[model samples]
Target: MQTYARRLALVLAFTLLPLSGCKRTHQIIHHATSSEPDYTPQILADITPGHIDGMKYPDFTDIQAQVNNLYDMRDVDALWVKGGKPTAQADAMLQEFSNAMQRGLRPEDYDASRWDERVANLKSPEGAALFDVALTVNAIRYLNDLHEGRTNPAHFTFGVKGYNEKKIDAVTILNTQIIDASDVTAAVDAAEPQSLQYKALKKGLKQYLDLVPQDHSDPLPEMNPNAKSIAITAGYPALQSLQQKLTLLGDYSGDANATASSADLTEALKHFQHRHGLNEDGKLGSATIDALNTPLTARVTQIVDTMERWRWLNDDYQNAAIIVNLPEFELRAFEGTGNDHHEVFRMNVVDGKSDDDTHHTPVIADQMKYLVFRPYWNVPPSIARKEIIPHMQKQPGYLGAKNYETVDLKGNVVSPNIAAIDKGTQMVRQKAGTSNSLGLVKFMFPNPFNVYLHDTNEKALFTRTRRDYSHGCVRLQDPPKMANWLLRDNSKWDEDSIADAMNDGQDNKTVLLPKPIPVVVFYGTAWSDDGEMHFFRDMYGYDDDLEKTLNGGRPYPQKPMKAVTEKDA
Candidate 1:
């Protein structure tokens, strides 16, 4: 697009400058067109690349187009310099740069530590111009990282499809919102995600960063290899260490040195288990010890990484949507927007099994358009071929026992003969009834993943601590609750109507919602909610992928596999 981006360049010229004007040359001198920016405010003359700028800034390579447009809007004149000194706005921005860690950003990445020296060295017009240019570059970089993220979400491969949603122009926010705002800090703050979830993580990050350990504590004793649970007998070696950890985490409030009462120890252990994604049985098992041994700083890093993923979500959807956090096996429906958004409801969910390739739930976002009542269970061909057909071949009465039958491509009923099923000429489907695999209702959404939220016949699975037993689709613990809330605005449907539709031996039917609700299947190993921090099992090593990418540094791999669209075809 443009030539080489303006970088930090050295210069020697005028020593001091006036605060107001360097000399404003009016272009189209009298009445300006709508598109032209006011040249009257641009104080310094067009800066020469290296002759006007410093070592604090490198070439503005990452944000090429937006940076060009920002500079061009003011006709290459100095926007940061008024007289010879950095403006109050520049100071406000510089202060924010130093405090970037609170926003899960590295201050040094934006030249936070280097700004004061650069500002103090501004002696001539050359120095002033370079200072102005360097500030522009760093400010843009900081805002871009804060608004979207340091790296793109497409790099993490968390979603079924790369969730590289369109990013907002930080340059526009800088030009319009931050530059002349009465409150610069608030304006810069406004650039970040305003959702409650993001705020919770940020709060936790600040709290943990403040307490990040300088040195490691003595390691907890390893559990016996075959032991199922740690014994809580008096004077146990691991008990004291566990107590210390529990106290640090706010789980155990009593004496860290004293041997705790059996009941108190169990309760604290349960609290720790709940915060982590483990069975809240209060037993100090190996998994719990593993979670306990995890350093506080590691948790902070985990949170920072999760915050980066939040930037990938669609802004509108982030505020109000049904979000399923895979690792937590929970879905929360949030309503409203900004920090004021409240969780409408939440329910435990059964996500896909992770022990195999075909069953892992894919992360994605889409509109849940309708609900199907008494939906027939159209068994996927893979499942049919691997499990169903083989079972039926051995047990001739398996089809009848399981309420399954064969169907042709045209939706006509056919014999459950082995030949047709083996030849792939016919597909298997369970009848629409209470005993159907898809429980009594089906919530449909459009995505390439071919997954949906639905009621499941095996409701008992919800009782288990680990509920990843489904085949890619999400199984709701409380389908009736989900239906009632989702259909609250539809006059014809109430709790009774929804219950009636889900039962009564009716044929499979679908109800299109009056308005669609956003549904997002998400994966985050660490989350903060209600002023409490949560850490979950990696479940799918997504955390590993993200941590690797973050450590590998810049030019983050975006879209490891390109998304196909009609434009490409």
Candidate 2:
């Protein structure tokens, strides 16, 4: 332990120690990489710790350690600061913190007395703790700003000398070009193989890093030596096409046309597409190309945004969590510590309808409970009034024909004669069946929106590249498969037993949750891991909106009002 501590001290000393020669070398690397005509001066002026090129000055071991310390404290601080009132030290710390972040200066360079004042403001134990948490949160953000390309390595400037600020201006022009334009997707389609302007833009976008790195650290168990051939398939060709598109995006030099007969090559591609939210179709397609075309800078922005959201969540988020990618229309359940022991439990989903104003689901949630097999769809009153009633009105005995019954709030079954009931006031209840709105299984969780994962009667929708056919709730393409996974850990319920339940063709078998799991439904336009950036279509136009917000077009609360009120209200 003492040796480890000494090594840490050495690393810190390396980062803190000032040297004339190293700064000159950094200046040289900065000039060498300075392709921009405008950024030459700014780079020289802000030469500090944050902007040091990782490729050139590789030993960030000390700075990395300091950043981690700052993060730890900042997390604690974020919890305790309340009511927006800062104690003197807190105020000073916050100001110095923000200034240091903005200037890209190191935290240690800031006045410690400012922190002292904020600490002085804490009269109560609770207040002190709160102040500490806020301080820690600020420090964490400072670290993030350094790591993400948002702030300079040593200075807190929003972009590198020339790239970041100007790139957004250019992207703004592109966004404008799309506005009032009919068929924006078609415009993107026509520009495929990328226009020269877009090529430059793509390069600029990749200049930033975002998102947690993919868990490639875990070495997969050795496969059978004799297993030379494994059948490869992607649920959607769009994803396969996306890989080729990314190859173009990355401009991978080796071979574009090389066919992979090697089992490892095929397996790797599947893993790649799967990680990128592709259908694992193994076959490349246009949708995948679109995903590949997304730039890294934008993905970095996503990471910045998601990290901010992380601050809003409770510390419990640090534990095991399930993240559902809404655009990919997929659910992934993971169990583990931070970047450790994380394994996927299941993946399958259909998305929200593209045109439905009310059905778009955000990808943020807390707890997920029981798995309902052969679940019944209690027809929402709105759907009953809007869709079912219309059908009943047009065709006499329609409710009876569809095996639907009428029920009161008391749960008393009242079989209403479709011909006799008042068309304007009466509502019908649909019984559970193979033809029921919710198919054989539904994963239930308490949430503001009554959305949940359920089996779908329209199984064919999952095959579409744009799988947004559902009203709002996620419709699993393979509910039986998901059911098997949910039951895998249960001693009484095995895969075969779950399959038997689904195959039994029964209705409404509600199974209580053995251990409730957490599910987070989140939407991100950009995501990153390692160095690769994956982009998804901004289904809700969130990326564009966020970009607008960042550019000072509108406040966040006002921007997503529709999504908020529709989901919560």
Best by TM-score: 1
User: Looking at candidate 1, what is the lDDT of residue 138?
Assistant: 76
lDDT of 1 by residue, 368-461 (tens): 8998889988877767887898899899889989898889988799887777777778988898887887889988876655688889888898
TM-score, cand. 2 vs. native: 0.52
Per-prediction TM-score, please? Answer: 0.82, 0.52
Off by over 4 Å in 1: 1-59, 81-86, 113-131, 150-166, 180-182, 214-216, 255-262, 335-340, 392-398, 416-425, 560-569
Best by lDDT: 1
Model 2: per-residue Cα lDDT over 1-569, one tens digit each: 75565556455545644753554444333433333122223322222233222121222342443433432322212222334344333454355454442222234423333455555655554445434433433333333333232312112101111222211221221233332234433333332222121223233343542111321122122334344323434433233343354344453333556643334345555555655666675533444333444444445555444433322233333233556667767666665654453556645577666576666665444566788776656666666666776887789888778878886556567766543234433446567767877776788876645777788778777776567677777877777766766666778787777876765856677787677766656564444433455555667654454455445411122222333312210
RMSD of 1: 7.7
Clashing residue pairs for model 1? 8-54, 9-50, 9-53, 9-54, 14-124, 18-83, 52-130, 53-130
Ten consecutive residues with minimal summed lDDT in candidate 1? 5-14
